[model samples]
Target: MTDIALVRVTFDTAAEADRIARHAIGERLAACVNIDRPCTSIFRWRDVVETAEEVTATFKTTITLASALAERIAALHRYDQPVIESWPVAVDTAVAQWIDDATHA
Candidate 1:
């Protein structure tokens, strides 16, 4: 495994997803972000089960930047509890090099 992670975050809207993506890339916290369109989300909120449409943003970056990226996303997220998850990325030389180049640029 590489010292990198793939961060997954879901937002209430496309605008929200775009905002987080731009901020993360602009801050060098992420090398790139892929935004997925609105999709159905089923979860419990405030003791009530609910379903809502949401957009998902997946970010690629080093583990060292994960905390800062999460903090920034939380600060800008509209939801009281945003979906922010990170998973370790298995190393792939080409992809890892691209990530390093993008974040360092």
Candidate 2:
């Protein structure tokens, strides 16, 4: 069975996002990566509240590869605590097959 998943991550800069995306593709961790424009993120770090501009990237991969993709992203990320999440998505059969074919566990 083919299962599709989306791995979402945020980076400090666009370059970082691109770098990670390239690495993921090269390593067969993700089928495709969509890099979004800069977005403002607000959160609390430690004892203080903070806000910063970040670039978000969504990795199209298979359910089997989602964990490995997230691990790779964390290893290559520069942030002390990077936002890396994976969610199962219901996609068309064709898309699910495509992702499964592209991603390697």
Candidate 3:
């Protein structure tokens, strides 16, 4: 695995997803944020099953910054408990280098 990380977040709307993506890139906290097509999410919340349309995004960044990026996303999200997950990932050497440069302040 490379030193790069992939942070995943789900937002209620497309607008919210775009906003966080732009913010994270502008802050140098992420190299790229891929806002995926809307998806249906099913899970249990407050002891009840719920289903909703959510915009998912995958943020590329150095593993060192993953935690900070997740925290920032959580703070800026509208959901009372936004879903944020992250983990280190494997990448080719060139891609890893690009991620490193892109996330640097």
Candidate 4:
């Protein structure tokens, strides 16, 4: 396993996603953020099933910075229970190098 992870989060709106993305990149908390808009999310909230249109943001960063990055995203996100998930990235040398460069850039 690598010492890095790809963080996935969802926002209620494109505006919110944009804000979080800008803040993360601007602060060097993440090297890059990929935003997928107008996604339909289905989940349970407050003991009720809910469906909403949302934007998904995938943030690339090192595991050492994941906690801080997650906190920053939570602070900026509007949802009371925002979706924040991180997973390891396993790939070849070239892709790994690229991720390192991007996260440190």
Judged by TM-score, which candidate is best?
A: 3
lDDT of each: 0.86, 0.91, 0.92, 0.83
- Could you give candidate 4's per-residue lDDT for residues 1-105 as a string of tens digits? 345678999888888888988998888788888998688989888899999888898998877788889999999889887879988776666666666676675
Error of 4 at 43 (Å): 1.1
Write one digit per residue (lDDT tens) for candidate 2, span 29-89.
8999999999999999998999999999999998888998899999999999898988998
lDDT string, candidate 1, 3-80, tens digits: 678899988888878987998899888999999988899999899999998888899998777777888889989988
Between the candidate structures 1 and 3, which one is better when assessed by TM-score? 3
Off by over 4 Å in 3: none
Give the per-residue lDDT digits (tens) of candidate 3, residues 1-105. Answer: 466899999999999999999999999999999999999999999999999999999999998899999999999999999989998889988999898898885
**What TM-score would candidate 2 get against the native?**
0.94
Each model's total of backbone clashes: 0, 0, 0, 0
What does the lDDT read for residue 7 in candidate 4? 93
* Model 1 root mean square deviation, Cα atoms: 1.4
TM-scores, all candidates, are 0.91, 0.94, 0.95, 0.85
Query: Model 3 residue 89 lDDT?
Result: 87
Task: Write the number of the candidate with greater lDDT, choosing between 1 and 2.
Answer: 2
Q: What is the lDDT of candidate 3?
A: 0.92
